[model samples]
Target chain A: MNTLLDFLRKYNYFFVFILLEAVSFVLLFRFNNYQGSIYLTGANAISAKIGGLYNEGVAFVGLRNRNKELTERNIILEHQNNTLRETLARLGHVETTTEHNVREVLRDFNLIPATVVSNSAERINNYLVIDKGENQGVRPEMGVIGGGGVVGIVYLTGKNHSLVIPVTNRKSSISCRIRGGNYFGSLQWDGKSFLRAYLDDIPRYADVKPGATIETSGYSAVFPPGIFVGRVLSVGNSKDGQSYRLEVQLGTNFSSLRDVEVISTPYKVDIDALLDSAKVKDEADQLNGLGL
Target chain B: MFQTILSRIFWILLLTFLQVVIFNHVHILGYATPLPYIYALLILPSNTPRWLYILIGFCLGLCIDTFTNTPGIAAAATTASGLVVPWFLVAFGPKDLGDDDTLRPNHHTMKWGPFLRYAFCAVTLQCTLFFTIEAFSFFAPLDLLFNILGSIVLTMIFIVILELIRNER
Candidate 1:
């Protein structure tokens, strides 16, 4: 008893360190997915205020760039409006109502505007912080897009903030297909450059051309079909001789991302629940088939 | 002693705030996150109790983890750093130093060569441990190596800059 007491007294500090670290590790590994998400809301709110101040100081420097971008956007909108007017005139003979038009517009695409609060480009698994959150209808697995093209998928959501796993992160993989080809593969970041990613699982037999645009296939509930991902920069045969790896230049300049839109799909929950139940039934059927 | 404790606490808080508020947001190169503020925790007085040092280190890292949404990453790294600091101090203890000594490594106190060596080892170990745990089980070996080296270089530069600023002040 005396020997044990002496040993404990001598190494109490080490024991405490081990105890605290073990507790922290358990907390981290167990509740990491959800509790860590809540921290972002408070952090975002505080950082957003600080970012606001920082933006004010640098507003003058960015004015010219912002003006140019707005002007270009105005031109595009004007052109789009003209085309729509022409189409409306052509469809004038058909019975048209305000409700039909509103539905038509809403059916094409829904955009939820969000501001970038924090962004990282220098990590293998980079995440972007956006101001919109669950309250704003931004949920995990929602698609995010910026001015350039497909930005990323929402991974974590807070009360009034969310974190996006951008295409630049190795952890993010988007199901993509070539614009006119039957071949599909996963678009994954190689943690090398912001402008580039790798397309894996593409069969060597498929005719892949450089500059072929890749877009979301709408297979996932997160994004609608035909959302631009990037263009193939280069392609090479893999070591296995069964697959080809294509280097793609991402459409969005993740480094300069400021404003983004979270895509909210109304049918997500219903579809997800149906699919999950189907999976469970399939597993049960498989088990029954294996019974003696 | 009270002033010393108060000042150290103030500096720790200030550095932690700056890390999460300003430096954490700065992503300079596409895989190298600079964490200059960690130096504040690294340079705590050598006489601080081992258990207290480890606890403070854990808290420091936990605070960062909470802010960054990276669970266990900073905590693991900071704990490792705290464990190693005592060894480092004893190994590099100043010759003929008095028991009442409270001297810290700075431009005025320690010679430039020994100070640089000490700072390099401490900062390098911190950065290496941090990157190792953060990239654990998720990244390629080459990627992990690059991240550690890149972060250390950037962090070293930032530390030197801070030292210069402190010297001027």
Candidate 2:
């Protein structure tokens, strides 16, 4: 015991270093595949509160520009809605069947508006904290979309804040496909540019073109189909050359992401159950995969 | 003594705030994000206890990581730097191994040259490890090398400017 005490007295600091590093490595690997621990992530109350106040201050700085962008987006969406409504009226010969619009009929989902309190893009695995959480029905695995397009899925949720696995993260993979093409592939970030990602496992025989619009494939319950993902930038052969790897320009501007709309799927309970089931979970990638 | 601890805590909070609010958002050419929170770790009094240094470094990096959502990556990197600092001091710092408890790494205590060397080594070690851990599961080695080097230079510039200001004060 005395010898142990003496050794500790001499090497306590080294022991502390080792212990702390060990803890860090454990935490690193534990939540590596996904954000597993809420306390360690940005969704924790203290960091979220700080980030919330800070982003609120920053949001004040960009108020006018944000407003302008929203106004422009509103104008475009309104125009598209008008065109869709006219097309509906022309086809069905009824002014409207109900308050439910054509787009709402396509998918029974609600957009839970949320403000981004913290966002990072320079890092390899980036995440964002938004100001809505469990109290506001923000839960893990819900789809999040920004002003431009698809942002990411909500990873964890606190009482009043939630953490998001943003599109810029290396581990972020979303089921997506070319708008008109039947072939599909997963959209994944390559830890480089915030504006770009790679479409994985796209076969070489599939007809892909530069500037082709990519959209969510709706193979999973996280996000509905046809949400704008990005535009194809270039097509190249994968490292093994068995598949076509296409460079894609992501729709959302990750660096400047300020606002997002969390998608609330109507049958979340059913979706979550299916996602959690053993039989379904076995082919989780197929449920989340694009083509293969 | 109480006042010094209080002031150090204050500086840590301030640096953490700056890193979370401003530096995290500032991406230079979409790659380099100057982590100013590292200043808090680098500026701790050189005579600081090894256990305390390691603990504080872990908490400091973990604090920034919590806000950034990288979890243990930051904590591990900063703890590694904390472990190597005293040794680095032994090499480049003034020869006062017996009385290191009071001499801080500030320009006021050590000459600017040794101080800068300490800062460069500590910052390089921390940033290199941080980027390596972040890129371990992904990214090519060449890309990882570029990431480490680019971040080190950027973080060095920020730390130097901060050190200069700390010097003047």
Candidate 3:
């Protein structure tokens, strides 16, 4: 017993070092189950509160740019509204009731405006904090879009704030398709430039060209179809030479991202349920066929 | 002794706040971020207990992790660096120093070359461990190397500047 005490006394530093490191590793690996631990998430109340205060001062410095972007967005929205009205008039399906017009406009999705409180583009997996959260109808898996285009998707939400996994993150993958082409590919970041991402899995035979507009495919319930993603800057072949990889310039300038709109799709829950039931039914049929 | 401990606590908190509020957002060329918070570890007195040194490093890293949302990467890196600091001090620290000596490392104490070397190695170890764990993969070796090298140079610059400011006072 005396010898054991002596050994421990002599090497207590080493033992403590291991103990502390083990604790750190525990926190590290456990963090992989993202959003399960509120204390570790970026949108935790303390961080969000501090970030909110800091961004308020920084946001003031970018007021002019924000104003200009908002003005341009307003003009674009007005043009789109006018075109829709003209098409409706031509079709002789004019709706006089305001409720009908509202329903028609918001038939598929609703946009929840949120301001970015904290954003980082330096890390391999970048995340953002927004002012709106569960109290404001923000939920995980909902798509977020900014003035330029898709910002990211909500990953976690707190009471009054939320964390977003932006497109620049390596884990973020959005299904995108060329404007005129029916072929779709997965858009992913390469952990290099904030403005650039790669769209993979385009077939070799698909006609892809530089400067082509890329937009969402609407195959996922998170985002509706036809939202702009980026423009293709160049095309290259995958490492295996089996498919085409298109270099894309992401539309959203993440460094200056201030305002974003979370796409709240009420029908997503229903669509998810339907898909789950279909999957279960298919599994049961396969089991019955196998006599299991 | 008590007063010194209180002052060290004050500095740690101040450095952490600066790091979280300003330096965390300052990404030069979107690659290099000056992590001066590790400066708090570098400035510890040479006679600081090994166990306390490691504990301080862990707590400091945990504080930053909570704010930055990077839970364990920083803590692990900082703890590892803290564990090795004594060896580094023995190697690059001033010669003829006794075990009981309480000397805060700086350019004046260890001279420019040794202090720079010591700071560079310590900061590099911390940053390398940090970026590697955070990335958790070597898929983009070039980008990872770029990030590590950029952060080392940027952090070294900040550490040297802080040392210089301390000299003035």
lDDT of 3 by residue, B109-161 (tens): 88999988998989899889998887776879888888899999999998888
Off by over 4 Å in 2: A34-292, B96-101
Residue-level lDDT tens digits of model 1 in A167-272: 9988888898898987888888888899999888898889999999887777887777777778899998766878999999887889888767888877788899
Chain A in model 3: its TM-score?
0.62
How well does candidate 3 reproduce the true complex, by DockQ?
0.24
Q: Candidate 3 chain B, which ten residues in sequence have the lowest lDDT sum?
A: B97-106
Fnat for each predicted structure, in order: 0.44, 0.81, 0.58
Clashes in predicted model 1: 2
| Predictions in order: lDDT | 0.78, 0.82, 0.86
Residue-level lDDT tens digits of model 2 in A1-292: 9999999899999999999999998888786654344335634777789989999999999999999999999999999999998677546743222212323533668778888899876789899999999999888999998656789999999999999998888778999988888778998888988889999999989999999988888887777887888899999999999999999998888888775789988777786676579565667757787328
How far residue A277's Cα lies from its native spot in candidate 2, in Å, is 99
lDDT digits (tens) for residues A164-225 of candidate 3:
99999999999989988898999999999999999999999998889998888888877777
TM-score of candidate 2 versus the correct structure, residues matched by position: 0.43
What is the CA-based DockQ of model 2?
Answer: 0.32
